[model samples]
Each structure stands twice: as C-alpha cells, then as structure tokens.
Target: MLSAVYKSLKKIDTYLFIEQRDDFSKVPEPLLAMFGTAELVTVLNLSTKDRLGIADINKVRAELAEKGFYLQIPPPPENLLKEHLAKLKEQGKLSEKYNK
Candidate 1:
C-alpha cells in the first residue's frame, strides 16, 4: 500500500505516515500538536518495501491498517560517557572512587 510520509518540523528525525496524502484526520490533535508542522518527505509504497531505514515495516503496516496512521520517533540519544565508564570498568581501569 502507498503511504505518505511527513517529517516533523519541531522534532528532529520524527516522521508521521498516513495511508492517504494530506490526510491528518486519522491523527489525534495532541499528537499533531506535538509533531508541529509537517513537511512532506515522500510517498512510499509499503508493498514494495520489505524494510525501512529505521522503522519496522511490519509494525508500520500494522499500525496503518489498524489506526490509519503511524508515528516514528527518533531513538534516544546514546550515552557515550556512560558507555565509556562501563567499558573502563570492564577493563579494570576505572578507579574505585569513580566506580562507585
């Protein structure tokens, strides 16, 4: 099925997908408000795609079929410092004062 994809102006990497182009009626008001203005990204043919860059194709299709819309939010930012600390601890390099 063909789906219209829109990028959220207010949130980076956030997208909204709907079955029909220019149709936001299926999307709720609170979600729309949070999404802010939307800019059309592309019209994707889900039938042709087995997977998407970030979102799961099956989940997107299921949500579209059940709710008429699908929302894609960015993944949480990586905690590099926390990861580094864990790595250091694993390597037995982290000081006891810092490990606590």
Candidate 2:
C-alpha cells in the first residue's frame, strides 16, 4: 500500500499506517533498514480495528486499482472534491491510471 503513497509526502511529524487489510501484515522493514540509524522515521502499526474501526480497505483498494495507484492530494481549503467527484460519478466504469 505504501507503493501508493503520494509523491509529495508532507508534514510527516509522525506516522502510523493503521493497517486495516489482512494483506498488509508485514512492515516495510527491509526498506526501513536500508536507511538505518542515520534517519529518524516514526513508523507505527494499527490494525483495521482501531478507534472507530473504519476499515474501508476495499474502497481504498478499488480506488487504487482504478487509478493504477493510490494517491490523494490533500483537499484544498474550499474542498474541490465535488469537481473530481462529479467526474468520477459521471463515468460508468473505472479505468486504470492513465498517465496524462
């Protein structure tokens, strides 16, 4: 799932990948180890059964499949989701990410 991380990861003061899917049971330990003690990265784990326990893994997966990758630009202050939402809603089907 980390493969779908946004290219511009921002303000990562701390992070925990609240894993809700059964598929992602292993940490990207090998990748992390490469950095070693030189870097400071805060990684934590949380199963789908966290606070609210909202496991929308399927939705996330579908979104990733449609986009050929999972990524989300943080919403703008005015919330432009409607514009994208409209475009997506208008489509009868989803397609893999098209590199425009």
Candidate 3:
C-alpha cells in the first residue's frame, strides 16, 4: 500500500500516516487540532509482508483503511536518557581522578 506520512510540529515524535496525501481533508477536526500543523515527512510504499523500521505495517494499513489516518507516536526516550547518564558518569569519574 502507498502511504503518506505527516509529522506534527507541536507534538514531538508524533506522526500521522495516511493512505493518500490528498486524504488529509478526511482527517477529523479534533485530531488535526491535537496534531497541530503537520509537515509532510515522506511517501513510502508500505506493505504488511515487508518489515518496517518503527511501526507495524499491517496495523498501520488497517487503521488507515478503517479510519482516515494512522497515528504514529515515537517510542519512549529511555535509550537517549540512558546514554546521556552513562556519558555523565564517565565524565564525573574522569573529573574525580583529575581533581585528586
């Protein structure tokens, strides 16, 4: 299935995937309000049989077919936070040795 992706400016890490780019008009008003002004991310050939990077292709297709759009919210920021903490710990250790 051909899908068009939209990214929300107000909501970080949030997106909307639709079957057609022109179908944006079909999206509900309340949803558009929550999503804010969306920017086009990309148009991709998505298939259920093919593996997607972040979203399940089948689920996205089903939602797009039934509802006018599919919401694609990004995963938690835990990995970035963990990496930052690890870097901070390393810096702290280096500072302690240097100070000593």
Report the lDDT tens digits of candidate 3 across residue range 1-100. Answer: 8888889999998989988985787788999999998899998887634866688877888888798689988887678855766687777853454443
Q: How many residue pairs clash in each candidate?
A: 0, 0, 0
If scored against the real structure, what TM-score would every candidate get? 0.96, 0.25, 0.68
Candidate 1: misplaced stretches above 4 Å?
A: none
The lDDT values for all models are 0.98, 0.35, 0.82
Task: Point out where model 3 deviates above 4 Å.
Answer: 77-100
What CA root-mean-square deviation does each model show from the true structure? 0.8, 13.0, 5.6
| TM-score, cand. 3 vs. native | 0.68
Q: Which runs of model 2 end up more than 4 angstroms from their true locations?
A: 1-58, 78-100
Q: Identify the candidate with maximal lDDT.
A: 1
Better-scoring candidate (lDDT), 2 or 3: 3
Query: Residue 20 deviation, candidate 1, in Å?
Result: 0.4
Q: Which window of ten consecutive residues has the lowest lDDT sum in model 1?
A: 91-100
lDDT, candidate 1, 1-100, per-residue tens: 9999999999999999999999999999999999999999999999999899999999999999999999999999999999999999999999999997
lDDT of 2 by residue, 1-100 (tens): 3321212233332222322322223435553343232222322232332331232456545554454332233333565765665566568343455312
